[model samples]
Target: MATIKDVARSAGVSTATVSAVLNDSAYVSPPLRARVLAAIRDLNYSPSLAAQNLKRGRSQLIALVVADLANPFFSRVVWAAEAAVAAWGYSLVVFNSDEKPEAEQRILSRVRMLSCDGVLLVPVGDSTKHLQRDPDEKPLPTVLFGRTVEDDKSDTITIDNISAGRQATEYLLDLGHTRVGSITGPLHLTTGRGRLDGMLAAMKSRGLAPEPRDVRSGEFREDAAYSVARSLLEQQDRPTALYVASGLMALGAMRAIADLGLRCPVDISIASTDTIPGIGGLRPRLTRTEHPLVDMTNEAVRLLVDRIRRGGEVEQRNIVFQPSLVVGDSCAPVGLR
Candidate 1:
């Protein structure tokens, strides 16, 4: 293993000169720089980037913690974050908490141990206690993505989840769906709760309400949505339309409808919030509200990088993007064939 010392000795220069040449932190004479380069090439020396970054008080790595990586929506987030992080001259490190608060805490602990420059989190728990900084130490630069929690002071980048739910439900209502049902995400997280609230508000404005049996809550997972959809749709008096909360859950509901031999927009109409990769390829071409995924991710990275460069003196910011409804073939008028 050739050290900086070895390279310096071979180049007949002081260690400081070798360090300067390697880091390009200071100007070196052309001849001296050429000698150092020759010595490095002959010795096959590679400087430790981790050590160099540490000495500069930066890891040059940003941590991204998502609730469920298996979900295609989050996978898309990872793809966008990778590009955006690279654009900001930082590397991204990903972590999945699998929607468990304990797992989220453990991942945050690991992020601290790695000395990640900052974090972009999709919060799973009801509070941000695990992400709190020490009193004496500087606050970790963090931006909560997609969701939020209680007692949180960090900057946030999120979608208007309530508007997402309202838009999808309103679209179905405009299509003359009166007997509407829903398959909801867990009622605890902000994304889940706000969306459901929006759906209910939209329904109330139309002088309608869902039957108790028609509203079912499940995890933001395909399998869970499939099971819940199957149970909800199998009822003798099922609603004529459904408002699903998430894209993956909508896929599950569509699958369940297929297995049950029910045709969408005919036997029952479907509308949902959010869309994921390959969702546009479905036979019915799902009608849903779509998020500005790439734009939101880019903004999140920009805010995180800004926070990292300028310490925590700035006021906390909460940026929310709206969802736009994309009409497709899956929905129809209440009595349309």
Candidate 2:
């Protein structure tokens, strides 16, 4: 194994010079830098990240923890974060909390110990037990992504679900839908609950009471969404519009609608969240709420890097993105028969 000393000797430079060149700590002559690079290549020397972190008291790695990797929303969020972090010369480490506070806590502890630059977490629940809740003692620069809870102080980046939900339903209302329903994700997650709140708010605003029986909660999976939607479609007076909280769930909702010999705008209208781009092809472009994950991620990374570069106490900041409704063939003007 070629050590720093070996590279220094081969490059005919002092160990300190080699260190500065590798870490970009200080300006090194181009010739000297070139020599050091050549030596490193010839020796196949890899810089010791641990040692560098120890010396600087911080790591150039940002940890992003998500509740569920299965959710395309989270996946897209991570993808956006990755793109943004690299621009600032920082790397990202993705952790799947798996909706478990215990796992989230373990990962938090590990990230803290590793002296990571910062952390972006989508908390499983409202309580951040895994992370010490005090902003003054905030062990690190941490931002909560997509999941908002009790801690308003921690940096949060999420779309206003309530607003999005309201918007989705309002679109259906504009299309002459009076009996509107919704399929939400787990009530345990804030996103799910918040979206539900939006649906109710929209209904109330329009002088219609959102029926509880019409609303269903699922695991944010296609199967659960499918079964729930199928059951709903079996009702005597089925809902005219369904605000599906996810793109994946929309697929199930569409399938259920198809099974019942229903058509969009003709029978039931759908307004879903997150295009997800790849997995499923939503025909004629389903009316959807754009999550703005790419933009949110850019801000998250910017905040993380800023916190690391500029010394500051643990402070909570929230950046809420407003979702845009993309009108498509999935929704239509209801026919009064």
Candidate 3:
């Protein structure tokens, strides 16, 4: 319970000198600085973060809001973002919106109260209405990550989800999978809509139309995907190959296939849009389109920090990363079985 006053008294120096030494805000004589350090160690004194932030006129805290932390993809993003922000002498506060717009709004409001310097948001859907600031109020320095909102003024860092979906579907098509099915994320979000659009567009190029029953919404939830996948697999004319939009949903679909006594790439092949940590250890390694998550996280943090430093003077930036296809053992040619 040693305060700055106690340390100052122990060091025989004024409180201002102690503050200057602790914060590195002003140069002190070498002897005085040594005495202050010795006193701090002796007294076990710790500077108050609130007081330090107040004196500096900034909290040096960044908010990172994600749609779902339970998903490994987002968890990896959080890890990388935390490390990136730490390197810049800032701390990251993570929030999960559970893919709800209202929750996202509430979190943003809380960020304002916490005096956060900037935000890195993965929006729930295409709704940027919640992000609109009043004309008199300064906009929060934010970088949208992993998802995009229409007409948003904030910087954005995302992958080409449509191209990712198209590539996954095309790979399956190349393997001669004519009756391909899909478990898609919610259609309201750009990630979901763009991916589904890509898959359909790729199928159209081959002069094939997907049946309505062949596509189902997983809402980016594992349980929902499990149910949807189970139903799809039970159909009399099931698709020989299945394309899943998210890594979490893909895991669920794999579970459903296993529960039904079906083997991947033997009865039905599977490909997906995302590859997450530890996914390689699965029974049948998933063929997937991979996002550069660590790179994207670093870029997002860098953009947000720059915006925070430059305020309105910084120009908005939109960065889109390309997805890479990673071929695994889960997919095979249609007739191979």
Candidate 4:
């Protein structure tokens, strides 16, 4: 069991000098660095992991917390972030908050215990206060992803959910879908509420009422959306077109429509968000509001590392990217309607 003391004793230098060398601090001279390396090699003195971590002030570890990993969008974000983090010589600790603020906060506490450099969080808005270690100052550099920072709170990196929602609805509108319904995610989340706002804005612009009955709420999951879509179809009259909150939720809605022997853009039309890679391979490619999950992840890691370099620096910044729509097989113009 070799330690810093042993390395120093063999090198005939102070323990401080050995630390400077092992941690790759620039203060040590080339001669001193060479001597330390020589001694470490001859003595087979392995640097203590705990000592190194302490000296570096960080274990070169980061945390990425998201709402749902099983969802394709979340998975793509995690993948992109992990790749970018590794390039900066840091490893990532992944956490699935399961859309629960309590779970996200619990993971944040554990990250605090470790020598973590920073965190990328997609918060559960209603319970977001749970993720805050300090109301005024953050205990670690954090980037809020796909979510908004609490008023004057953490830094943020988000896709324009509102714009995305607006775009989805506008696509339907351009196709002459005047009677449109929406299956929205629970309004407790910023993404959910923001997207819904966009939908309403588009409707209002067209001089239409954002009908209360036309919009129903569901958890941002497949099953919940599926059930809602089924209920919409059971009514005596249904919308000519529907806009769903998330891509995964959209899949469920489509399946429900299929079970009732309805057709897309023929019997009914769909415009929604989130498109997994698998969607391209579907017999009918899905039209969608496509967020740049990978790009957003890269930016989040970049911002976190910059903040970490400044030692948990304070800066209130928000990066919001707009999504684009892909007009695929799922939607059609209303001329045939």
**Candidate 1 lDDT trough over 10 residues, lowest sum:** 130-139
lDDT for each residue of candidate 1 in 1-337, tens digit (9 for 90 to 100): 8888999999999989999998798999999999999999999999776777778878989999999999999999999999999999899999999999999999988998889999999999999887865767776799999998888989898889999899999988998988889999999988888898999999999898889899999999999999999999999889889999999999999999999999997998899999999997897989999989999999999999999998776788999999999998889899887
Number of clashing pairs per prediction, in order = 0, 1, 0, 0
For candidate 2, give the lDDT of residue 167: 85
Between prediction 1 and prediction 2, the one with superior TM-score is: 1
In terms of lDDT, which candidate is stronger, 3 or 4?
3
lDDT (CA) per prediction: 0.92, 0.83, 0.90, 0.83
| Cα lDDT for residue 47, candidate 3 | 85
Best by TM-score: 1
Worst 10-residue stretch by lDDT in candidate 4? 124-133
lDDT of 2 at 242: 90
Q: What is the C-alpha lDDT profile of model 4 across 1-337, one tens digit per residue?
A: 8787888998899998997887676599889889999989988888765766897677788998888887777888888988999999999999998886777778888888886878888887554556556777555777888877456356788888889889999999998888889999889788888889999999899997556787998988889889999998778778888899998888888999898888887878898977776767764567789987788788888888888887545567788898999888788776474
- Residues 1-337, model 2: lDDT tens digits: 7889999999999999999998798999999999999999999999787877788787889999998898776788888888898898888999998888888888888888777878888888668755764656745777788878785556788889888888888888888888888899998887898888898898898799767888999987788899999998789887878999888889888888888787765777889876675634656468988777788888887777777766466465778899888888888777642
Candidate 3 global CA lDDT score: 0.90
RMSD of 4: 2.5
- The local distance difference test score of model 4 is 0.83
RMSD (Cα, Å) of candidate 3? Answer: 1.9
For residues 1-337, could you state the per-residue lDDT of candidate 3 as single tens digits? Answer: 8899999999999999998998799999999999999999999899888987787767989999999998888899889999999999999999999988899999999998898999999998676777655767888888998888888888999899899989999999999989988999888888998899999999999998688899998688789999999999999889999999988889999999999999998999999998778888897989999988899899899888899988999788999999999999999999786
